[model samples]
Target: MDDLNAIATLLTKPEPPAEAVTRSRGRLQDRMRGRARRRIGWLLPALTLATAAAAAVAMLVTGVITPAGAPASGREVLLMAAVSAERTPQGSGTYWYVTREMRDMDIPRQESWTTRDGRRWSKGEPGDPPGVVVPDPDPLMLKGAEVSIEDLEKLPADPEALKARLAGLQGRDSAMTASEQRGDPLFSLITLISELPTPPEVRSAAFRALATMPGVESTGAVEGGHELRFPYPDTTWEVKLVVDPETARVTRTNSLSGNDGSVLLSAGFIRVTTGWTDQPPR
Candidate 1:
């Protein structure tokens, strides 16, 4: 059809007005432009594939894509796990069954030296047993075989009481406070976090606390949200936590920044996909 049109144009010799010739030339230019556009459009996918291949090569050379979806250099594996049970009819209330695999660093058995707290004792040098050090039972265990927002509701609702209870925890004794400046800022900030509320303040107090911690970032939703971050140089030690909007209960919690993930250090939501199914404990 295009060939026929071209032959017809070549054979036709009707006298042409200058304006008509100009119009004919303009139409030919328009048709040629359209064809050029179609040809470019056909190359778009090839161009895109080539661009993607270049980016993949660049990332591979820069070590951005590590083994097993792990973050590249300067980042550490932030493994997390959460368990919730007894889904409510409204589909809004679910009991937080467990948030294990938190960070806890027990200085190597051999590296443990003791402090003179009324008596001199050795924590044992490396390669030696942890010695006669007694283990403090986890309070979370005694709270219940299963924990819920309702259970926390029964506790003293007073923030002061809550602060006192939290302050009494093992690491709290060494916790630095706002008044305890001049010392380690990290320890002081950790103590202050013990007073955090379900939906973080996001304003004066919470904002100020977050500022003191490093690598600490945040995101939120209309109703509720959280912020997980690390205050230290190491990426392995971090905090993860979430809250129940209505009851203000800590619904999800875990951490991975410590040597052994067991301690609740930071509080925030993390990106993950978890499923709920009742299965007997192994």
Candidate 2:
């Protein structure tokens, strides 16, 4: 029923099983619409990568999670990301496009194009059964306080003022998680940096705010970028964001448990690219 999905192929990869790709598509659908996660068993991963993306996939690798007593390196890493984001040009197009794939899983890749008014179109790996281009109408969940793309664009660019704006918007929803209830502006503003379609200045503000948050640490490098870990109040696990400061994009994110301190891919995704494109969604 859609023509826009026929746009150029987006990713290069060996193909995956058709069944797995179909299932992945449905799960992705649930996420795009702001619905609660359906537990397929194993622990329910943290909500950091939930909206606009899934939790993670790889599991059970041992690591460490310690609060940074003096996080000079950590501060520097985020500050660098802030500078990089400011320098990077923000491009606009007819549709906002994102290409994401489940990490370490055999599921096929997925792509989406969101219209300016928030209508979304998604397609799974090539040659899977044809699926309709459904529009996900739900607004983004800013850890409880709902916001449209337009509202996110209006956020302030100054770090302190941006935190203040999110703080004011929090607590409006009664069903907010325990983390959201605690009123952590650092946590709330981070969604803006990682996945939202905010302006580069807004993202720069978020990175600066994250730099000053207590217990954030630069945990050394990964394959594509270095790992940045930070504590979340009232949660047993700290958050790990694998980011390339030069590009100012989060490549991967997941929770590091207090005990084992492992990075589990079963809970999140590897975001290949998210940006505006003239590419149409079928």
Candidate 3:
């Protein structure tokens, strides 16, 4: 009981230097802004709002006193993202081309193109030939099947219907164990849609659908944006979706493993620049 009391006392101890805390908060905010520009492609006019929200989060986490006004919650963030997506401008092109960066366990920076029709292409890194087209044998798989532009367009735009469809797919895969099947379908949907050239309305629907899922909780604001934590069924890792509420788009996503906080995968994708390009990728 004495040892337990000692641990509790340490946990409740006052934090160190206010100046240090303030500096840390500022750095975090700056990092978030930089990430927003790189990952989201564009910043919304309401970036000040995002800054304030991030400040509120820093104060809350560090036990610093903050001004009044309820900090945005996870559900509110998702819903706001939906609204933002709805207001986004649509694009037109002969072929949908998306540029993205993905970091998995092995690769730190893997830049690539995602095509609506599943054609593989990538921009060569510095010192490599520009516009190198590589044949990617991989298919754009969603919900255990290959997806095309037509498939994405056919997806339900209503939140409830979309949620139901995602939930229905949970147990349909016979190969997945029951535990593996319990993964958050809403997250999968978001990741898939972010990589595709979906219409603004469809993307909005995807955000709304996420808002309706159980266990979707906010971890408050971080550096780049607000984060939503989704627990996968029977897994130690949780999926975190960082969203820029001002732009109503996902800025970054990561799967964090175990108590040690190891990252399994991180992907940053944007479709804002995607359009039908008559010029084929070289």
Number of the predicted model whose lDDT against the real structure is largest: 2
Off by over 4 Å in 1: 1-96, 99-154, 169-217, 220-226, 230-238, 242-282
lDDT tens per residue, model 3, 67-151? 3333466766766566556656766655556444443333233334555556755554333354556655545555554556787
> What's the TM-score of every candidate structure?
0.25, 0.64, 0.60
| Residues forming the 10-long window of minimal summed lDDT in candidate 1 | 77-86
Tell me the lDDT of model 3 at 170.
32
lDDT (C-alpha, whole model) for all candidates: 0.27, 0.56, 0.53
Off by over 4 Å in 2: 1-72, 106-108, 124-132, 171-175, 255-269
Clashing pairs in 3: 32-223, 93-276, 94-276
**CA-only RMSD, every prediction:** 24.1, 17.5, 13.4
lDDT-based ranking? 2, 3, 1
TM-score between model 3 and native: 0.60
Candidate 1 lDDT over 36-107, as tens digits, reads 211211111111222222222322322233343222121111100000001111122122122222223334
Where is model 2 poorest over a 10-residue stretch in terms of lDDT? 55-64
**Alpha-carbon error at 274 in model 3, in Å?**
6.6
